[model samples]
Target: MSNEHFSLQAEIAELENILRTIPEEKAISRLSFESRLEEARSRLAELGEPVVKEKLQLTFRGQPVDGTSGILADFGGKAVEVFSSAVSTVMASINGDIGERGPVAKKDADKLMITGTAVGSFGFELEVAGNSNPLFEEDDVTAGGVVEIIQDLLETAATGTDDEITEVVDVIHPRALKKVSEFLGFLESQKASCGISFKGKSFKFSNNSQLSNAALKLKDQNVKERPVEFEGKFVGFLPHSRMFEFSIRETGEIIKGKIGSKKIDIEQLSDNFLKAPVGVTLNSVSVGEGKPKYTLTSASDIRAKAGGGSQPPLTQE
Candidate 1:
């Protein structure tokens, strides 16, 4: 295990070296580091991020959403992405406590040590937004914002006689609090109501007659045709095609993917190309196993701290 850990560390250092070779001037784009960082994090997680996550109490505008579950979705398998602003960066060195009577080589190997940790929290605000139906006739009240919706409903219930907005908050907030509970239950219900489907289906990996013919000659009666376009952030090699052209985003993310002059939504691509090596940039992640500690990486971006303290306070803003 120790050897494997060292090997992985060496691999990361090598990757860093490769990235450094890319000219600094060329890699100065604001999105470059983020994109690359996401990619690295994704790959590392796949190889084993060695990081951890903890279930967080969810809330929105001080109103307890009732239920919430957070997954290191990018790192683990769950997906309840919360905006984490409170990140604490730490660096420490531990001295060798076990003294040795032998030569200095043993001491040298165990001596000076430096390690850094990025800790932050990922929080979710439970607020729902909906667009007014175009077919419906316009009404004086709107159900767009959560607070507004609550206010509108309360006003109607009281016939505009009593104040329900503030009262509702004051009453429900303590009862539910900010921590959302029963997250997986909600997800299960959603799954039952709305089937989870990826958009990028029926993608052909190759167009060569040999490859295409092989696919056409599938023997698996239950096998379904895959529909996903394997693509890249910066460049994509046409495994088998005449020519390819597309505007590449400077951030190495993506503007749009054009296949034979047809635009495609990247989200659709992501869904279709699930399990394709993806990169992710995290503000922070928890450590330890189930009840882990969280460390922040993109502290500034996560919190938008303005030279004040560490990060922004956790509040639905």
Candidate 2:
């Protein structure tokens, strides 16, 4: 087996051993047991295979909600099939799983459509238009695809301008508007401006704060620490932290601007200089003030924009 696979197995084994040692007495602290369980589960997650059955929940208007009719695997397969089949079949499947008295009427099926999909730690949730047909086939839908669609939708809802937000509020269902707005506000507070990505239906949101890189690298114990460097355009200054922000040209990932102990008056720099291209190197990063902070070891290759006039490089030795 590959080294990575072997290491993951070893970690899982260690966690399992630790879990076994934990006493099963009622006197055991609930927090202690929960902490151990969480660690074990996380290590097992590194195995990259579903280790436990995922619960599924389905909700339909005019029908009793079925919170746990089946496992995620079964539900995922059925969802794909429903998306691909005729509208009638989709209605029948949903009704059958929920123990509804009868198949939905033709009028209801016409209203059936996939409103939205969201992924959580436990599983995925799908919102449908009034008995709406998702109009997707088994071949076209995958768990990852569902996640991407949701992430894109959420990002749009979160980052859109005020005008856009108003339009979204007017268009989306009233029930979902509040949730979308709340999630958007949360993302803003967390500085999730680098956008949201996913791993196995779980979100990995990127932030524009200084300590993002370090936090991401250290967030998973299974991940090894390493030096990171990137080239990007000096975007702007965050006066609140007295740092200059850079936008990675290739990935669009924002580099939380830092100057370390270097004595440079960023406010004195011209707007063009602030917008020049820069190279940044980071190591031994940490989080502070609710954001990632890192050593500003050096900033090099400062290139000014064409026609913006010549200016001194903003490199730090």
Candidate 3:
């Protein structure tokens, strides 16, 4: 593993050198080089080495940035908020991609590191850090993957059909959906345009007033009425899908839903709670017909009544 790690690192260094030599006007050559570079870095990261997985050039264009000194102070503060919010959006989506739901923890939502500036526009290059930790071995979605989703969602919002936009938004973490909505709202409010570029692909947001519709759609999705708790037996859980099954104690009914807690220990849950009496709190969303969609918010073991008094109930959120 050590040898392979170093070898991958060396390969990545060489690829970066070749990529730097490639002219941006040579689109095909630059793309090929960048592809190879990203592949090498991904491999290195998978070996537990920290790698710069995604590089984005964020360029802001508007009267706020039209000056010889730099960006306006008032706009700069809002711009900082916009940049941080974008990173948080990516972090929340990463959690969702890895089958973890709910808001991202501060420790888990590391910001993209700034790395130099763009030439013409007042902008900076944001570098996303990556590593293949053991915890992420199963459903690892690197920073690059998250960036691709952002690009796709933005592209869809700008041009795709309503159904297409909804489809993409549905997959995003609910928290991220809200953040990106705010991100777009900030852009619209300032009447400023911005561009995000990764490798050969670039997306620009200008007079896209239709983004208001997308923002409304996102806000609507985040509206949850209230949480309802149920007493049941923990039947099963699928880690990759973040889905769980429960058998209700009251009516002998079976319910399945998405799990929203990252603190759950799969092994402990299987050993201690499976087929055991438990309490589940869920947030339900109505879908028009049939059963509503459920998201499990918190759960607790309630097996103490059946000779399990020695151990305190394990609860997680």
TM-score of 1: 0.13
Query: Residue 183's C-alpha lDDT in candidate 3?
Result: 78
RMSD vs true structure, all candidates: 29.9, 21.7, 11.7
Compose the digit string of candidate 3's lDDT tens values, residues 5-62.
7788788889888878888899987887788888887777667643345577777776
Candidate 2 vs candidate 3, lDDT winner: 3
The per-model lDDT (C-alpha) reads 0.25, 0.39, 0.63
Candidate 3, residue 52: lDDT: 40
Clashes of each: 19, 9, 0
Clashing residue pairs for model 2: 83-136, 112-131, 112-132, 112-133, 113-132, 113-133, 210-292, 211-292, 211-293
lDDT of predicted model 2: 0.39
Compared with the true structure, the alpha-carbon lDDT of candidate 1 equals 0.25
For model 1, state the Cα shift of residue 270 in Å. 59
Return the TM-score for each candidate structure: 0.13, 0.23, 0.54
Please identify which of the two predictions, 1 or 3, would achieve the higher lDDT against the true structure: 3
